[model samples]
Target: MKRRTLMTSALALAVFAAVPALAVADTLDDIKARGTLRAAIDLGSPPFGMQDANMQPTGSEVESAKLLADHLGVKLEIVEVTSPNRIPFLLTNKADVVVASLSISEERKQVIDFADPHGVIQVIAAAPKDVDIKSVEDLKGKDVATTRGTTNDKEATTQAKDANIVRYDDDATLVTALVSGQNNIMISAPQIMNAVNERRTNDPLEVKFVLKVNPYAVGLRKGEDALKAAINDWVKTDLANGKLNAIYKKYNNVDLPAEMPKP
Candidate 1:
């Protein structure tokens, strides 16, 4: 009887797991009715997402998520995520939208849709200035640390084939590893690399080479047209009014691109 019950439960779970994709209208309506917008942000990525001195969530994407919820006339419910699980959270209905620093990639596009981009981030290879790393070719046999399951990971894995890729679970861990001298060479954002340099001042890291400049957007599950349209509209308005750019620049110390790329 126990085995039979377990089988029945498993069958029910499988059916339940398939419901999110089919509940397109419910995703948007539910948020409005619930009076809260579920916005997933990864606090592990500083400048993009992190905690303040008070331990309150304060960062670029965190503020952006707040703006989104406010624009929708709803309260914000932050759903913390990591580099690896942002999309999974959205697809599983754990998050109505993902405001993590998720770059728009053809690879990701195959799995989920994205709103219009509100910001851009440059992926770079950084290392202690003494280390000679001029390009991907220079990464041969070097230990390159990056957050696992991120775009930097994909770039390093595919492009820096000769390098020994060391992936941490998230950006915070990857940054900590760099500061403790666990890894010298790494593929990451300039902001993250700079954060590491601030700690290891005696042996500062520099941008060895730029890997890519990607426009990041809010991620949405496919078929959620209402949510996508709402997010896209908010991005356009905020970008035009300089609200989004202000929030981005406040945290990143750099202005957003002159024009946002479409997702």
Candidate 2:
């Protein structure tokens, strides 16, 4: 009887030890208590997130970040991040979340979680209007430029057979290459191409073709259920009430997407 009771007690203790402990609590609750939600944003890209004349961050993405901070009832802290460092920033806790124009990819899913898709973008190829380029096949053995460390690079590499791919950190360098006749063509987001065209109407480049379409989303650390849930809820509410759509249209001539889909 003594041995049986000892075994039973040991089993009970094992079961008790196995009980799951919820150590990390709700992100929204924690943010509210802390009074600040740090959002890592890409200030290099225009019409999404960029610095103004006074060097203040302002754009559709910035406004969305502000709205999210407000919804969480905390102050908004914006950290300017680049394409290469955005994911790392979130993983290292340098920023609580990311609102960069981060495209959803299977490779990235291994390291971070993404919110619902907020924007749909297409990879468009452009060159001088006088050029006779008509399709992706025409770029064979030619050089193509795109923003470094972006979805555009992924698609460009896959679609452009036997083509030399050059990547720049931002639009300015990519555009400069094409204008200076250093590259045969340039590939980037359609909205960004449109912006470049609008800025230089007199010397505009032509879009030859759209390679592929993808969606952009906010990113958080993987396994952070609390943070992911809070962002998902916030996105759903914003999309349903037309807040998300309005923000995009208000900032640029592009129309807002009808719905925010899961990427």
Pairs of colliding residues, candidate 2: none
lDDT value, residue 230 of candidate 2: 76
**lDDT (tens digit, per residue) of candidate 1 on 1-263:** 99999999999999998775568667888899999999989998998999989999989999999999999999999999999999999888899899988999999999889989988888899998789889899898888999999899999999999999999999999989999999999998998997888788889889989989999999988888888899889988998999998998898888888877555
lDDT of 2 by residue, 96-164 (tens): 888977889888888878888776667888876877788888888878888887888888888886778
Worst 10 contiguous positions by lDDT, candidate 1: 18-27
Every model's TM-score: 0.91, 0.84
User: In lDDT terms, which candidate is top?
Assistant: 1
Runs with alpha carbons beyond 4 Å of true place in candidate 2: 1-29, 175-184
lDDT of each prediction vs. the true structure? Answer: 0.90, 0.77
